[model samples]
Target chain A: MTDPKTQTGSRQDEFEFFEESNALWWITLAPTTWAVHFVLAYGGTAVWCAKFGETQGVTVARLSIAGLTVLALGFIGWLGWRSVRRWKPRQNDMEDLSHPEGRHEFLGHAAFLLCIISAIGVVYVAMPALFITTCR
Target chain B: MIRSLAGSGRRLVAMALMMALAGCAGRQSALSPAGEDASWLHDLWIVMLVGAVILWTALNGLFFFVTRVRPNDWPERHANRLIIGGGVIFPTVLVGTLLAYGLSMMPHMRADGDGLVVKVRAEEWWWRVEYWPAGATAPIVTANEIRLPTGQRTELLLDANKYIHSFWVPALGGKMDMFPGRETRMTLRPETPGVYRGQCAEFCGPSHALMAFEAVILTPGDFAAWLEAEAAPAAPPATPEAQRGQTLFRDEGCGACHAVRGTEFDGLVGPDLTHLASRQSLGAGIMEVTREDLTDWIAHTRDIKPEVAMPAYDWLEAAELADLAAYLEGLK
Candidate 1:
């Protein structure tokens, strides 16, 4: 016969897995943003330097922005990985410990919302300014 | 593990197949060099590619063998020492040898003694080349096309008049950047008697993609004749259509973007049309100077080339277009 506590734990584990999976997907935002910024900044600067043959103050600014994106993305990936790894075990052992469902659920929801909002912002605000043609 | 080896082998095979396909396709681009320096560069690249293939195969083979043959939990706790020693020693030695070899090749690439000098200035969409011979007080300023005598070593002093750009001709040598405030030198000898096309390697603006030039290497006699022809003034048009076109050229403000020597047309914004009839292609090798192509281009340069600086002359009648085309073609 299965223990009632173990059954409850399995249910709680399922819920936590759902939330953590959502959070992990949400964490993809950090990497996506970083990658886009990196491509734009570095690629744009390279083009600018090549075309004009002069490195102005603006080129330095763009390159620095690219570097920062790399750093930020790497840090975010590390943090997200740590969070997900910790969450896996915590979800598995949920009913054994005190019910701490509220905090994990809230954070996961927040991350999901943030990701959606940022993605929308990128689509609406950034792409047009960066890619539209005016070459002469 | 076996899958990985298979995958790498597949990649190698795929690369080889692609190279074979490229060879068979016969899409010989016009911009490639047929000269000695270019051939040397190409050979060196092939050698390096072969070396890379061998190295990659050996490294991957070693990795595959080690992973496959050895158990995961081997008792030998540390192979880190050997790895660290090899990581430091081999790269240091290899890189040093490469640097030395590259340094040895540099002097030959940079001609030291007296050579033909061509000053190249990069604008937004065109190249202005000034050829100055040894002991000459004046230099011949030409646009788009650079004619050089075959077997003559020429040193190009390259710089951008407005922006950063790179000068490259695949058959001549590698690329060198043209900085706004700085000048970079490149040496090349066109040993072959053929046209070598080149483009602005750096992205400058919208028209950057279309920016192109050519090096027309000719026999000694032909080159001399070309030089003499270029030094002479613009000749009068022979045909009635050409005469009408010349009048149209004056009336229609064609003088705004181009310059034809010994005429009132003195606009420096575009290519010098002084010897327009002499060139094989119009608008810096964009298209052939055929009657229909010239009419289409002159009628609507913007339509043909969206980002071209030249405005369209769509207002002209068909008769006018033909006359203009005839006149421009007779500018030789």
Candidate 2:
């Protein structure tokens, strides 16, 4: 059997490397998608409205908004899927207070929850395009 | 204790009822919806209020149950489920549905450009109203009072000459901003024939609180008659005293700022006074349109409305002031 100390040292090294490399950026992946959706929706509508008066820019602006919404939803959904995969708990993760991978598991669980929320937010944000009649 | 609790509850219910009833009593009340747009807004407000009450009650009930009824520690999985379901799913669904419903109603609130159009310019402390009748070369210029045909959708082209202002007639429709160099539009279709009050919804200056106007909705025939009368020049001042007042109006340099059609005082710096006497109020609805009020406004405008653009004519003799008031009041 491998030495227990060596195993612990390797695990510590992995966690440190993960931290240094900023591998946990997936934690913010969901919110980042939301931010992108918000900016594009508002900015696209404003630019379209300014370029083509209220009455004319309806079609292109709305189509673009719809496309962006779908893209954001898909991206967040993929992130959620990855988070779910990462959140597979070890046998004693719940009961083992000193579990080495507990932090990673908790981060994965939080990221999954946030991704679900962000997906819902993306859908909610996109709802304006579905109903708002342009330049009315 | 039970009796006292019941009494307190009854009092609370009574207070709530009174508060709700108060919303319906004001002339400038969105709750007292007199048009289709205002009705939609009122209905939306009620829905949001109901949603808020439900959320408040549910959250407080949950809090009470968790703290007082069952104080045992919940399992981590159950807590997590509650957080995700309540914090994430519930609010997202609720707000999403509201946003969709609200956005869907936006088109109906806007005009189809199928009705009469009125151009309104917001100045420092007054409104310049121009009525665009069908097939008219020049818009019939008026001020302060807006006359509309009942049951007809009328569009207002709103602009600001100086600072930004907002046009709002709460009983009729939502507010639209008046931005400098940009014209915004809003439509109103009043269902009833009555006088409604409108106020400058945006704070623009020191006298913003006093900037108000009247919307007089009338039958089609009455509105046409009013428009015809409004389009005409003021009848020449009749009495010798009135004539003297007219001469004084010209001599006092009032012609530099005020315009009385059919007279030499064709100034555009101030409100048109061709039919000023016909209006319901003066100083933009701050005072009743009367000889006494007009005299007071002319003599002590600064005292009455602080920081208004019109300077006080306190130097005019009492008799001259009376003549000016009579001449103005006789224009109708």
Candidate 3:
């Protein structure tokens, strides 16, 4: 039989680990980065074309979009790498229900998967700039 | 029950086919493309339509097969394979291919930067046309009817004086928005000599439905001749009644909002009446340009088109109305 005080202390420790590591909150950064990149690329190109379409403005717009794509991909790759390192297989955990290391592992696995999907989404959105030479 | 469901599906498909066939013929139908730009758009539409039909049939066939024909005790690995292949891989390939194809065609849809330029300004319920010939000092101001030479690219500079409007000539090309204070451009090269109908695709105000125009694509010689005639002033009224009608037009304040070239009436508020009688339609393509229609339009302008800026002149005597219509009809 386990002491109730010991059980409460272990649960508190699990919650503390979850909060301090910020795994759950950081998972959303993948999609958030994709969304921000999409909006900036589309709006920047449209407004730039409307203002200065005939001159060197289109070159500037293309370069700016390329810079943003690289930055977003780099951030997502870093997050994915960090999550991959933290992720642990469920079999490695102790065969005890009260010890909840599985929860931390699950969070890491989800973050890693989400980051991959977000990176693919960003690339897909950037593909439009490759072929559309003009704003028309 | 299965037989009945199949019968209903057959009936639905038949009905859809009938409706599609019915929409194939019309003046404003994009399906009847008459120019290079429209031909490209039509080809794209056909490809997409064929792809959609195949996709829909395949998806429905898979659904039916899985539910009714497949064995219930299939292996778990098979089910997992189906989920990954049909759910993820198929959609990704399909959408990616479509996006690539659409992106490749974007640049080809725009103007090639070699053509004559025509400026079109969208008013509340009409169009103000200005011809900018090559190396001309000032643009030739015209209205409503746009005459383009067949087999030559013509670039249109579209702008708006008030609200947003869209310039759409279905047989020629795709629609481009006419934005106020900004100039947008579209190009069209008509392949045949015919009159195509155009309309303000954007809803501006109460009379939006009645705001229409015509694109007259003609032979090179005819187009040149027409342009020369349009550049000149209105021909003087020939008959006695027409001359009297011209006097009435000047005395009744019609000159305040309308302009007839080579005359003292140069109001810029309405369409130019330099060669009004030569046009095929009147009231912005709503009525034929006949003497009776003109008389009716003048007497009951508000009745024919509600909320138009032009007011009714019902108080004029019948003979005077006839004389005015004759004069306008002879301006060409």
Candidate 4:
């Protein structure tokens, strides 16, 4: 088998034109954004209620949540768009996925799908802000 | 004589289920709602249960058809669509819709309360409930029992003195937690007039399960009269035994923790015993408020509620115990 990452001294397919740097980081970036937003939303609300008491700073909390949600979804959307445009499917029956081209497509498709799911999660986490007006 | 084994097993299972379900209509069951919030929760539960049953039947029907009736694999032309639609799109849409529906009801579940305010402090293994009437300067204090009026929204401001405890009355509404420095609010608008049991939903200490209280939802007129009476002084002892028992009560130094109004025993560490005789139960709803239970509780305080700060009076003779019990029972 050829080297999976570099593909040195190996025959390359015509579709193998990928040149994204630090490619594996994109797979984890979307989920990490979701986690950060979740923690900040929960911890911020709890601290705000404990210190200021009954709905004292609810307006500010809601605004911060809305802004954070938009920022997170925008970053994930960019990653998803980039991955979808660069994605390439397997061509024939005899193609071995151990080749560099097949591996690249698999990673790209996986990151793209993860971005979609993470975006949904962020949306669900933020939906409560629309209904729950109080600090509770 | 028993019939076939399978038939006997089915009959036994049916009888067991019926016996289990018979316990659902009581003071603690959420299914038997006495308030508006609990009624809505019961309705939401029914809808969810029916939706789950329908989904289960449909999924199982598809499984049986695919596995048993159609053993041959379908053409590859339709394979990708079937895989994507069944595994991904169907679940995403279903869960998303359900989540949206659930979130939409969040604000209404904890709606604002505009009626009378009743502040409750959750102490170790007991409740210190105070009612703030419309034009009162100080709160009317009580313990181990809560009373609310019907046809109006009653707001409950919950807090804790030491450990984290939860105040839950299933027949009235949902549970609310109480922290030492923080306060949580919940509103209950009880429409039915009856007695219900409230318990500490969070496990706080050694006798957490034994920490419970009785809640009475009364008509507006009856509640007004009851509140007026609760604010007054304790009635004087009527019989000779009760009078001597009251003297023994003060001599034994029981007044250090428990308070009895209209007397010199003005303590604040434990429950108020001014109206002890009128209450439904004693020792935080562990036993009936009868002469026998009162005597046992006063003698065996530590045994009745473990880790409680109340001291035991086991050194007192049987006649002294009986007189003290009689005194407490006559404080109505």
Looking at model 2, give its docking quality level: medium
lDDT per residue, candidate 4, B1-332, as tens digits? 46688899999999999988877688898889999988877776776776667667766776776689886887754655665676566666666666666677667777777558899998888998889876668988889999999988888999999999999999999899999999888999999999899999999999899999999999999999999899898988888889889899888887888888888988889988998888888988889988899889989999989998988899988888888999999877
- Pitting candidate 1 against candidate 2, the one with the higher lDDT is 2
TM-score of 1: 0.63
A1-136: candidate 2 lDDT, tens digit per residue: 9999999999999977787345378798899989889999888888888889455857787888899988898888888887766666544345442455566666677788888778877777777778776644
Return the top candidate by TM-score.
2
Give the Å shift of residue B109 in candidate 1: 2.2
Q: Pick the candidate with the highest lDDT.
A: 2
The worst-scoring run of ten residues by lDDT in candidate 3 chain A lies at A89-98
Alpha-carbon deviation at B182 in model 3, angstroms: 2.1
* lDDT per residue (tens digit) for residues B1-332 in model 3: 99999999999999999999879756676888877887877877887787778767877777777899994866756876786677656766676777778777777777463556899999878889998877778878888878888788888999999899999988888999999999988888878788889999999888788889988889889988988888899989999999999999999999988999899999988888888888878888788888899999999998987877789999999999999999999978
Candidates ranked by TM-score, best first?
A: 2, 4, 3, 1
DockQ score for candidate 4: 0.60
DockQ of each: 0.02, 0.63, 0.62, 0.60
Q: Evaluate candidate 3 and give its CAPRI docking class based on DockQ.
A: medium
The better-scoring model by DockQ among 2 and 4 is 2
Cα RMSDs, all models: 13.2, 3.1, 4.2, 4.0
**TM-score on alpha carbons, each prediction:** 0.63, 0.92, 0.87, 0.88
Instruction: Give i-RMS (Å) per prediction.
Output: 18.9, 1.8, 1.3, 1.3
